[model samples]
Target: MASDHVAEFEAHRPRLFAVGYRLLGSAAEAEDLVQETFLRWNDADRDVVRTPAAWLTKVLTNLCLNRLASARSRREDYVGIWLPEPVMTDDSALGPLETAERRESVSLAMLVLMEKLTPVERAVFVLREAFGYRHREIAEILDITESNSQQVLRRAQAHLRERPRFDASGDQRRRIAELFLDAARGGDLPALERLLADDVVSSADGGGVAGAARNAIRGASRVARYFAGLLDVPLPGLELRVVELNGQPGILAVVGDALVSVTVVEVGDERVRRIYNVVNPDKLRFLAAQCGLVARNWRQVIEDTSGSVMELRAARFRE
Candidate 1:
């Protein structure tokens, strides 16, 4: 019986983590919630549990909701712009990214927009949009009426209506990232400006620990000069590699075995619209450990950039 229980939880672990990560936007917190859910599952009366998956999801989601109340308080006092902690999505850590919607649901842009939502609204939106949960099912999980669930979802959508829509295809996005990388590294302000949209915006989250722009930098020319100036200064042993982050093309800055920063962009009409750089050491711990675990030698992976980006996809890193 114990073995059977363990097997059932194992089967649902991935999905639970997916929902948790999306709700909280912190892989480390999501992982902790998942473990706590398992403890509750073990303590619950299995005889009355009709569906294990639903039970586990409800437990995890509520855990996240409880955590979000406190999380928002922390963010209010957080230093600088607080960006969602990014995870390498090459291995589908947050769930299947086969569709554009699924990918967008977990993207850094969407995650940032979600911060504006109320806890209940965020829960309803994530359940309906990301996991395809029916209103009736959502009502059960959230202890609200079906109509209330639908209304909450609509409200959440309204809040997130400003989310950027990317016009670039996967290949185009990669190409743009590559070009941006080259231009930034070479300090080519003209090339950077040409690639940026007129209203391009750049924001950095350094958690006040690492040096970063305290305020968002806006406008194409200003943003271009910012990156040109930022990247032009050479730091010895700093390596930049283009890789998929949160299901979209992004760049990773690393020095030796340490991850220094992660940059993800939103492109529309083949022009870069928004650039998000996360340099907070606290946020980089999970991804940095992932890097160390997947690649035996970071230099080898960094040197071989000729192949497709998929070639460097980190094998699913387990906690």
Candidate 2:
């Protein structure tokens, strides 16, 4: 009986994590909620539980709603612009990214926009949009009427109506990221400006632990010059690479084995529309572990590399 319970929980672990992560936007917190859900599941009365999946979803979603309330309060005192904790999606850590909509649902841009939504609204939106939960199912999970669930989703969608959509193919995004990195490193403001949209916005979230811009930098020329100046300064042992972040092409900055920051670029109409730079050490913990940078000799791999910019794939990192 115990083994059967364990297997059942394991089967739903990935989906639970996926739902939790999208709701909270923090992998660490999502993991905590998932563990708590498992604990509850262990003690749950299986005889009365008609559907394990729905029961787990309700438990996890409630946990997230509680967390989101406190998280918003804490963010009031948070230092600088708080960006979502960046995660590598190549391994499907946050669930399937086979579709553009699924990928956008987890993007840093959409996550940031979601911050403006009420806890209930965010829950409804993520459930319906990301996971395809019906309004009736959402009502059950959220303990609201079906009509209320639909209304909440409408509000959430309206709030997120401005969310940027990336229509570029994966190869196109990678090529653009490569070009952006080269231009930034070489201090080529003209090239950078050419790639940026007229209203491009760049935000850096250092979370008060690392140096970053407190306010968002806007405009193509200003954002271009900012990156050019920032990346032109050479730091010994610093490496920049184009990698996949949250189902999109992004830049990872590292010095030795330590990850310095993750820059997630949003591309629209083949131009860079927004850049989210997360430099907070606390936010990097989960991703660093995923990349095997924790207590590993990954620095030796960097030392062997010839150039500052290269492709860092998941397999290469594990090797």
Candidate 3:
């Protein structure tokens, strides 16, 4: 019975980790929290529990709260800017809509905005918005009153209201990304400049764990210059291969068949608003296994989805 229950728990680990990662904004910490939750579940009397997933979520949320408390303290002493660990997963499993939803939720800009909320506020907001948990479920998870959960959610939503949301379809984004990639690969700075937002910003996360820009690159012209400058730096053997990252157009830097880095470009209102270059080896561990990367043609996928899983596939297609 115990072994069977463990198998059941393992099956849901991805969803739980996804929840934790959104709340905490750190993939490594999310995995740790999920692992700890399972350990607690394994040690507990399962016969006494009614909803195992709920129990695990509550346990994981509490652990994340504690971890966030400590993380804040440690971040204060951190040498430079702190970035959330990037998540690398197989994009083939997602339809275009699923990809877009996941990308929007995990975007670096979104993660940065999430940092504004207090840990409890973050937990409440994620539970209410991301997982669609009821106020009572969230209250139970946080050990707070239902009224408090509602209030926290209101504040979180208010804070998030300031950030603009993208409206382009998944097919549109993929097409736009392809054009941008073509311009960049062809060294057509003029075309690339046209696709970028006037005030675009770029950020790279090497975590100081590797070679990366320690700070964010701001302004559209500056970002264009940065990309243009890249062509000058002789990577002589490096090839820019475009792939679907987090459900958006991403470029992988391949050097003699080795995948070095993955970059995700954020598009807003038909303009490239931001670029997130993730070069951290640790964050790219999942991709490290694939010598030659592969992904579903999200644009094609979006256009052809008139089939059975339409609703389940909608969120992914609208990038």
Candidate 4:
């Protein structure tokens, strides 16, 4: 009987992982939460779990909400800017990211924007918006009234709306991404300007261990200059690979066997609106694993980076 119960939980493990990962951006943290949930499930009486999936979801959601609440203050003291661990995602990992709405829910931009939501709001938003849970189902999982769930969802949507999220379709983004990379590859000033929007913003996450822009660069010309300058000083054995990141096209930079960075862009109107450069070595583990390579060695990665923009990015990895 115990083994049967364990098998049932294992069957839902992927779904549980998805719930945890989307709610909490760190894959490592999500694995921890899922493992804890399994322990609780093992101890639970099988007869009492009328719907195992709902029971596990409720448990996972609460655990993530608690973690998010605590993580807020820690992020405040974080070294430099903190970005979500870039994931090389698949259909089973987060969900079928077939539609723009579904895909954007798990996008880096969306994950970052979720920071603004209150713990309850975040829970409601993820459950209702991403998972398609009914208000009553969310109410049960969150231990709130149906009306409260609806109100929270409304507030979450409104708060998110105030913050503009890039809504460009995949086809639209791919078109702009290819051109954007072409300009950025050679540091083409005129081409970079033509590809960027007037009010473009560029941000990087070095986690203080890696060198990165301490502050966001705004305006098209400035954004253009930032990337052009970065590409100007090429690291030895630098290789660029085009890949899909969180349902949108992105670039992966590898030096020999080590991954240097994963860059993604938000595009609209045939111009790039935002550029997200993730240079933190700690966050590239999954990218390295995906590319069948190891992360860049600290010493080797910094060889040509001295006196360059990368030298500025060699910030400490803030835990």
The predictions' CA RMSDs to the true structure, in order, are 8.3, 6.6, 11.5, 4.9
lDDT of 4 by residue, 123-150 (tens): 8998887789999999999999999999
- The global Cα lDDT (0 to 1) of model 3 is 0.71
List where candidate 3 sits over 4 angstroms from the true fold: 88-103, 287-319
What overall lDDT goes with each candidate model?
0.84, 0.87, 0.71, 0.80
- By summed lDDT, the worst window of 10 consecutive residues in model 4 runs over 310-319
RMSD of 2: 6.6
The per-residue C-alpha lDDT of model 3 at residue 124 equals 90
**Model 2 lDDT tens row, 167-234:** 99998998998999999898888999999999999999887877789999999999998998676444
**Candidate 3: RMSD to truth:** 11.5
**By lDDT, who's the top model here?**
2
List, residue by residue over 32-132, the lDDT tens digit for candidate 1.
99999999999999787899988998999999999999999999999999998788888777877888888889988899999999989999999998999
Ranked candidates, highest TM-score first: 2, 1, 4, 3
TM-score result, candidate 1: 0.90
In terms of TM-score, which candidate is strongest?
A: 2
Q: Give me the overall lDDT of model 2.
A: 0.87
All candidates' TM-scores? 0.90, 0.90, 0.82, 0.89
- Model 2 regions lying over 4 Å from their true place: 295-319
Q: What is residue 303's positional error in candidate 2, in angstroms?
A: 18
